[model samples]
Target: MNTAAYFAQIYREPDPFQYRQRWYEARKRALTLACLPRQRYRNAWELGCSNGVLSAALAERCDALLGTDLSAAALADAASSTAAFANVRFEQAHHPQDWPTGQFDLIVVSEVGYYLSAPDLSEMATRLRTSLADDGLLLACHWVHPFAEALSSAAEVHEALAGGLVEAFTYRDADLVMQGWGVSPTSVAACEGLR
Candidate 1:
């Protein structure tokens, strides 16, 4: 489906699969957040933040958090849900080519990577590598189940990111898979220290 049509459907009816409503999704989000290397972060950027449910959770751990989506309708819902958090902002944005200008201490790629083609995913990997701060952390989570229109699989996205980064750890089960990357050795050491 075209991006416009695809997003239009989502705008019309938000998919609970990506939201924090279901037990499966809630569990995945919790696991994603728990794997972070730090207790708190100065800034975080979450891409494809559908309805901001996880964004709300992330705001508690970040001094400043920006959640972006290609669909304005999604941002509307996000803005409403995150209104109480002064440190959180929502915007309509596309990835890789339109990545935000500043560095991010933490970046979340929840269910966003599969929307890109393989080459675009590679470009995104490069952009992510450049955008992360020296001691920053990157968390990636995606559903392992296949959709016919998806350009790549969850494993492929993780592989692309792994190729560009040093993998800190990973979590996987029947429903979803997550990968963590630390930008520097210090962050890796810190993650190891917790074990």
Candidate 2:
């Protein structure tokens, strides 16, 4: 399937993934937020920020956030959903080929990685390493179940991206797998000087 066309068709409805209505999505977002070792970040990037529901939540913890999507329709939805946040912006990007210029203190990859080919994912992992700041963190979340469009499994995606980084945290359920890596991995309590 044409990736852009597929997502464009999916975005025919405003909430294609039911991000706003689904309890699972909401809880995943909450877990993603809670898993961050730092309370706030200077700069953040969210890949595949379809409709920007998570971007809106991430904006609260970031001084500046860039949300990128491959589909124009998805970017439009993301822009509208995140309009209230002055700190958040949306862009059209096809990753592992298209990348932002600056480094980010926080990078989020959710539900998008499985769509990339293994070679592309490998390249993306390299780019992610370069784009991440010295004290940055990378978080990824994906549905565990296989789907027609997925070129790779969640485990494969995570393995490809997590290479050379220190793992910070992880969460797994029957439906999803979420993991984070950092330049210098530290626990939340350690970040808060509790340990």
Give the TM-score of each candidate: 0.92, 0.97
What local lDDT does model 1 show for residue 128? 85
Clashes of each: 0, 0
What are the Cα lDDT values of the candidates?
0.84, 0.92
- TM-score for predicted model 1 compared with the true structure: 0.92
Q: Estimate the lDDT of model 1.
A: 0.84
Listed per candidate, the RMSD to the true structure in angstroms reads 2.2, 1.0
Residue-by-residue lDDT tens digits, candidate 2, 99-137 = 999999999999989999889999999999999998999
Query: Model 2 compared with the native: what TM-score?
Result: 0.97
